[model samples]
Target: MEPEYWDKNPFKATAKAFPPGFHYRPTTLNKTRKFYEFILVDTNSVSIKHFKDPKDPNLNTHSTIQILKVMQPRHYGSNLNQPKKFSAPFDPTRYTYWDYIDAWTNVFWHQNNKYKHSWLIYFKNNTTYNFPNWFLQWWNYFGPIPQIYPEEVQQGFNQFSRMFNNQESRIPADLMYFSSFALSWIFSWQYRYGKIENKFDNSKAALDQVKNWFQVHPEFLKPADPETSLFLNKKSQLAIFLAGSKSKEILAKNLKEVLHLLQQQEEEEKPSKKKVESSDENDDQDDDPFYQNEDDCFGISLEED
Candidate 1:
């Protein structure tokens, strides 16, 4: 369904044939060969209609998009079977959001076009839920999902956080995923487009901002699973510390302390590092601390005992 904000925009449709539930335009890459359609199903998901023939919009495949994670732009291309990998020279820089329920649902569009398509519907279903294990594992190993735009995520979350702040009140379970998905959408097209594409530095800067937000609202990281919630908090903190140590500028007050703590950790784990180093030169992937046992990893011990 179209968001209420569409009625206030200039591209708001006036034609009688145009329904409120459908997008004003198609969102696919090939306008001639394909006719892709989108409709906002709910706050946390969208219904997709993929038409192979431009002449036959009615004859199409149906799918649903439930956003799981959002980050730099990447696509599976025309051959949908291939895995998505970020290649150089990313065109039309924007946050590419991944779907939890469906893989083929991934797409990128100009913010205005997305606005026309009503990418998000402002509806909250007062239900509670938890994230899938695979979803958590994928992001954790790859890299922590940086909050490039905390304000936007916070704004989207405020709708629920504010209402649920009262005693005995609570946010819907589904909103937790929505809050995570909201982080991906909050980005600057102009800044990202104009600046040199330094993914590491920009991501670190954005994540540094997240530390402030986390301090203000630790509940944002609290999922249903206590272990999972703790893991997420630790993962984010570890990612920030790792990013800060490699950077030239001081990110936050705690960063230096965290770096010193990391030094102590390195010193304590010198023997283990030596073993890992001597294991095999071919075992490059093993360098990632995320793959280590979570229970005993330095990541889990970032916070003071």
Candidate 2:
């Protein structure tokens, strides 16, 4: 044997090398469910792309990556009267709760608690797409969402709402907290579950969807920075505990004011922080989303959505 270099837990060395808990837990549970849900239509999305090009050895790998980035599903109306979000140019094409509902019903298999096997659906479907073996399981890039319970959903909604109650301002960019990372699923679920699930008109329901979510709690709009640890105010936290309706636009307008204010504060303090986090701060993007990315398919506009 080579020099006996050992520790109490052989696994512990690798685990400790990363942040605490980084390597210790299962992280795939959420994204798998979401993707499976995305492909639930009569003709699944992933099913259409199976191919192998004779010219390029890497064609499969290239195509596989492209498909995964298509993680956000786009649907169109056939005859359902309801159109899918981002579908082909139509009289109207925006995501509605009904389409979402139909998709999730089959995707989740929530009927029998044991349909939990649907969790494997993503892997199967991706393989079903018959992508190059290389990129198929290359790495797990997105996950750990939708495991949200109704309670946490309510809490996130409440946290955001309370921050805007009666205020007129911008909100902290980080007010969404994990939402910046999780909104692809959470915001959709929270609003849909909170407002439109009832027998309500489309426009009215959309407005209410935003409103009712912010109505209960407000802490959700404050900015969070690693340098400054600000706690959610007690009164604000209390309202989350209470049950009450709120107005989203009013709260949102207020929250936006707070965000603007915070943005101002950050600008004012930037001179000093420039000396500190200059190495850590990420490049800010204040312009259009179609900013160039040489790495992606050149013509697919980032602003398409």
Candidate 3:
């Protein structure tokens, strides 16, 4: 049977559309999201082709991996009144927030280069509502940052350090602590909900990093005065808890054993009143000197027989 078509044009073929003997893999930084780079490999010939979009004309089809260098920034207007904008300017500072996003979109969809395709798409699509204001302000304040793997983590730590060091930043210590805790929670959630690989390790590592930071910077753990020591102590306790061992299986087993012991104790504490009542109803009743009223009925008489 012939393949289906619409408007006499073939349907957009994703990585799954490729036939046997051709291995198709779409690479993305975020595993939960769509793939940015689509790579098609011919097992028979061992050749490979990489493309952001399969429909693009300038797809990089080669025998080996292609290394697309970062694009160089174009010169701005000499007078600053008019600015020169390239399709994908290498420097993000040259353009406004929205303009930079537009340029990045162009790079992802139009140009063929080594810029992180997945991240660009993520930032562009995710920040559409905020557009250039909040994003631009943050960018300008923090400057340019690389969105790649280890560098991303390093950049985040550097930013955190900058905020921590700035006395004028006015960011609360508890806020910072909670922010790190929230990140750890997010990583844990991802691992539990989506079962994303390495997420558990990442979450553990993040908690450890936060714990180390607090340990090293004892000042942050201290209160401004002795009056606030209680609050500070509570915060410290929470920090320790977050960084502590998270063995759920062991915890569950311990909880089960405790519950079982409690149940057994409850059963033991429940006296066999029926057996005592049946054995010596008259003798026990008559001996009970304190059992004068109905409220004092203990079934065992306290009077001398």
Best by lDDT: 1
Q: How high a TM-score does candidate 3 get?
A: 0.23
Q: In what order do the candidates fall by lDDT, top score first?
A: 1, 2, 3
Considering TM-score, which of the candidate structures 1 and 2 is the better prediction for this target? 1
- The TM-score of candidate 2 is 0.19
Give candidate 1's TM-score: 0.21
Q: Which ranges in model 3 have alpha carbons more than 4 Å from their true place?
A: 1-98, 101-133, 136-196, 199-204, 215-226, 229-305
Please give the lDDT score at residue 285 for candidate 3: 78
**Pairs clashing in candidate 1?**
1-40, 127-173, 128-173, 129-173
lDDT of 3 at 127: 15
Kindly list the per-residue Cα lDDT of model 3 for residues 1-305, writing each as its tens digit.
13542233222332235332122221221211111122111111112233444566554321122212112122222443343343432332133323332332222232123322221111111111212233344333222222322333444454445435335324443334323432211111111111122342333224346557656655554335564876577556655644553698756665576567658866885676556676678778767876657675658788898
TM-score of each: 0.21, 0.19, 0.23
Candidate 1 lDDT tens digits, 120-187: 21112332234344434433322213343244443434444433333332434223434433322222
> Ten consecutive residues with minimal summed lDDT in candidate 3?
119-128
Clashes of 3: 4
Q: Which ten residues in a row have the lowest lDDT in candidate 2?
A: 112-121
